[model samples]
Target: MIGRLNHVAIAVGDIAKASAVYRDTLGAEVSAPVAQTEHGVTTVFITLPNTKIELLEPLGADSPIAKFLERNADGGIHHVCYEVDDILAARDKLIADGARVLGGGEPKIGAHGKPVLFLHPKDFCGTLVELEQA
Candidate 1:
């Protein structure tokens, strides 16, 4: 079952610039940037009590995050992640209910040290869905 709503992921052209804006300008305390090689991106986390905000930047041209930026043509909100208690079961149930998963598999390590999976936007009324295990 789903737990609390986690961080909202945002795509950015430059992670450092985004971090400065979020931390210095917006007065949010940011965590040291973390690189998620498997996901093909780097990210910085802005911690909050209930949730966090993640700033994502593609690590290379082949990265899916890079394609995301190109497709949108503007760095902005990428997806909303909801924390779950059991990722495998969640994925199974979603699949059984006819939800289309992006990778159609188990949750993998993503930004902020959590196991994450992306559900196709087509399955959620054009809103990209993220399932995360904390």
Candidate 2:
């Protein structure tokens, strides 16, 4: 099952600008952008008291984020991540309960260097959900 709200991710056309808004404008602690080649994104994390905000920029034309940007010209909330005790157990349970897991039901190393899986948006009230190993 899901635990705490890990982070809220926003797809952005310019990560630097997005990070700046959270950092300079909002006075939040923002991390330097790190490119995640496997996921085809450049990520920046904005630390907050309770949770975090993740800024995602497309790494290439074929990147999923790129596709999302095409659909949303100004970029927008991409997904919400929740912590889980065990990713495999969560995946299995969700599958059994008739939820679809994206990316072939396999966990991938996320920006936090933890196992993460994306759930289908349609299964979760039009919101793409991400489960991260806690």
Candidate 3:
């Protein structure tokens, strides 16, 4: 089952500008940009009181973020991540419940270096959901 809200991921056309808004304007604590080639995204994490905000920019022409940007000229919220005590168990339960997992239905290393899995947006009320091991 899901635990605490891990982070909210936002797809951004300009990660620097987006990071500046959170860092300069809102005075948030933003981390340096990190390129996640495996995930095909360059990310910046903005730490928050209750959770964190993840800014994602496409890393390549074939990046999924690029496709998302093509559909949405102005980038927006891409997904929401939740923590899970036992990801594999949660995954099995979700699967039995008819929820579809994204990718190859296997866990992958996330930005936090934690095991993570993405659920199909259609299965979660049109919002992509990420489950991270806690």
Candidate 4:
């Protein structure tokens, strides 16, 4: 089952600009950009009082964010991540309930260095959902 809201990810054409807006304009504490080659994204985390905002930029031509940007030129909310006590169990239960898991249906190391899995957008009311181990 899902736990607390982990983070809301926004796909951005320019991560530096977006991070600056959060850091300078909003006075948020933004972390340095980190390249996640496995996930094919370069991410910057804007820490908040309660949660965090993730800025995602495509790392390569084959990155999923590139495809998302192609569909949405301006970029937008890419996904919402929720914490889970047990990813495998949650995944199994969701699958039994007819929810589709993305990728190879296995947990991968996320930006936080935690195990994470992405559910198909179609299965979650047109919004991509990421489940991260808590």
lDDT of 4 by residue, 38-131 (tens): 8789999888889999999999768888988989888899999999999999999999999999888889888789999999988789999999
Q: Enumerate clash totals for all models, in the order shown.
A: 0, 0, 0, 0
Model 2, span 1-134: residue lDDT tens = 68999999999999988888989899999999999888899999888999999999999667888878989988899999999999999999999999999989999988788999999999999999999998
> What digit string (tens of lDDT, one per residue) describes model 1 on residues 1-134?
77887988899988899999998999998988887777788889888777889888998657877777887666989999898888888889998998888875867776556788899998898888899886
In candidate 3, stretches whose alpha carbon ends up further than 4 angstroms from where it belongs are none
Error of 4 at 48 (Å): 0.3
Error of 1 at 27 (Å): 0.6
The candidate 2 region of ten consecutive residues with least summed lDDT is: 60-69
Error of 1 at 134 (Å): 2.8
Question: Candidate 4: where are CA atoms >4 Å away?
Answer: none
Candidate 3 per-residue lDDT, tens place, 95-122, comes to 9999999887889888789999999999
lDDT of 3 at 100: 98
Candidate with the larger lDDT of 2 and 4: 2
Q: Rate the local accuracy (lDDT) of all candidates.
A: 0.84, 0.93, 0.91, 0.92
